[model samples]
Target: MSPVLQIALALGSVVGLMGFMAGVRHLAGTWQIGSEVQRKLVHIGTGIYALTLPWLFPDRWPVYLLVGLTLIVMLLLRLPNSRLGATLHSVERQSYGDFLLAISVGVCLFLAGDQLYLYVLPIAVLTLADAAAALAGSTYGTKFFRVEEGEKSLEGSAVFFTVTLLISVICLMLMTSFAPPNIIVLSLMVAGFGTLVEAASWRGFDNLFLPVGLLIFLSAHGTSTLGELVFLAAIFALSIVAFKIVAPKFGLNAHAVRVYVTSIFLLLAVTDPQNTIFPILVLVAHIWRRSVAPCDSKFPDLDVVAALVLVSLGFLTLGKATGPTAISFYGIAAMGMLMGFCAIAASASRPVVRYPMVLALALALFAIREGVVRLNPDSANWNGPMWPAVFICVALTALGPMILSRVFATHRVVKLTFLALLIPLPYYVISTGF
Candidate 1:
């Protein structure tokens, strides 16, 4: 089909899907159905429709156009006067799920070009598994646990895992060339991590994290043997167990620990295991600060995890684009140093004390990173930052807490600007050796 015709059909199909969702919402409202049910209905419908993208557009521009228009519509739905908001916004918790859903579709489609299974599998889980978890939780959930935003039930998480495992198996069998052993290992891996991510995520972020994380994991480890995959899984499990044991000693909340652990495992799956050490140290420092002087802040832990993940993914992308250099790892380590500074800055009331402590921590972490590199020279080789470069990165990261305290000090939802500001520093430092 011609590009113009393809774009036309895509837009029409999206409009039709919206009309169907609106009709469903109207009927549900007439019947006094719960808002959550109405939202999930729309969610499922959107995901199912998204699955048809490979067939609809021969090029990605059509998908981008569709995503942009749909995102505008979703944002419009958030307006107080808009009737559509009633269905999607009925939940009490704060959420940007609708926005994330639209963005994930476009991004995932782009990443999976000419690879239908890569695209379909993640979307299917996003659709079927997520809806199943929500419904199962509401209907059958009994045991509840606290998270950053709200409480999730064990029953729901279990349902999510089961469904995700099934989806993984089915998608792999039909879509890939993996053997039975590989399929089993891969399905288990996705299911375990997906459940953790969903349980830990708040504010509709699972919509974004689920598909993107899946794509990264599949792309990175798709060709590994069963033993290799199992070894990776074992490392993830052991790390989680270790964190769970130590987190309480540091006075970190269960929710915060889960976010930290899940993000680390996601990193481990997507990149080298050693690459996880930097973020792990940054988190430990944050928790240690919390342990020393606990502050009562309502800012969600998931937001912190989201910020870290976003920054790391940026460096990781740069690594791929630049090709075959350990520049990405260096960039991430630099980010880790910046975050380490921010984490300490959050606790240190005096600049004199904070700066020294941050400097020491950064040097120590860098030393450790060097030791690891020396042990596994083939894994990565990159020069350590000079004293001036270290100071510059620290100086840049110091602005994070200051700006955050001035602008968002009182807000309930923490802005991502602190870490987002640190993004360019790593790239600039590593790319130019400045």
Candidate 2:
């Protein structure tokens, strides 16, 4: 048999396994609780498949076949009848729309020919950062850190940043063979950015933005030289300390701005040709923070400090290995701020009416942005077919949220939306062509 054929068979097996796990989770009542056990099982299973499939089947055909099968399974899962077949499918009907959105973004990134580290970073941010925040907020969050209309706690953000940092470092080590000396700094910076963006405005779309943002940084700088990298690390560390010291007197928003400014200067100094992205990101963040207007209450500032620390670390790590471009960095920063604002708005809204409208608006924005990018040949990647795939994704993303909101008004559609977002993730894994 041809190598491609063998590879195709292996991928088929992976798809089958994913389907089986999804079905089993649906059967176990634990899916409703957002059960960690179930989530871990699915993640572990998917990870194993991702790691072993290529070696098991050494050809492109198997990969393609696996992709086809995975899509089929996802489509089937979307069907009401299919869901019912899996343990009567009694999951809550929340705005699972975010999940679907996340999956779509992940697939788009993968198809864009992003690196392995780039591919895994966002997923790690979503899974680890989000989980840490929730767990810590619920368990250790004594004082609420209210920023504008958001409900994030200082403790929660701290946990989120810490977990995201660790996870990024681990992912970098395991996923990529290339480990520059300044990796520690790079991972910290990327994770910090990922967490801050996520904390400030994810609207649940962190899954999409975090990894893409990190990849932008990676693409810009390939990797830094040893001596220069060390200096960059020292600067980043000092910036974090300074931000922490002045945050209380200036306020969270002010602190965020200061950190933003410092990051820009550091990037300019370290990278050869200044990447415009960091400055643009700082500008956008400043604008967004101003737009939100600071809340009247005094909240604990630990989370803000932690987020700054982690982001600084991530940047340092990435800066050592590669330089970043202005366009990509700022674009990601803008998107992150937008997501954070949306998330806060959604949380503040009365789920019945306001949430749906927000979701619609987000979908619309995503569509318009995607459409503009697709139409403008100059804005897109010259080598790959990013436009068409992004166009399709935009349509599907818009349609899913709209339909769910309209039809499942009483049911919590958030979870379903989230699941739908994840639909494209498997395709990304297969298409990675690893």
Evaluated with lDDT, which candidate comes out highest?
1
lDDT by candidate, in order shown: 0.72, 0.47
Show the lowest summed lDDT stretch of 10 residues, model 2: 324-333
For model 1, how does the per-residue alpha-carbon lDDT over 1-434 read when each residue is reduced to its tens digit? Answer: 79879789778976886797789788996998898999999999889989988876777788888998888878777887877677889899988899999888877787676677778989999999999999999999999998765898999999999999999999999999899999999999999988888887888988988888888778778789988999989988898789889878766677777788878767766656666666666565555544553444665355456766766665554454455354434444445444543544454567667656656655665576565555544534444434445444545455555445554343312342344334444655565453
Q: In angstroms, how far off is 347's CA in candidate 2?
A: 31
| Candidate 1 accuracy as lDDT | 0.72
Q: Give RMSD to native, each candidate.
A: 4.0, 12.6
Write the residue-wise lDDT of candidate 2 on 99-210 in tens digits. 4333433342343243656545655565556666766786778877544345567788788788878877787777766465556766767666665655544233343434
Runs with alpha carbons beyond 4 Å of true place in candidate 1: 292-296, 315-355, 361-391, 399-434
Q: After superposition, how far is residue 400 of candidate 2 from its true place, in Å?
A: 26
Candidate 1 root-mean-square deviation in Å: 4.0
How many clashing pairs in candidate 1? 0
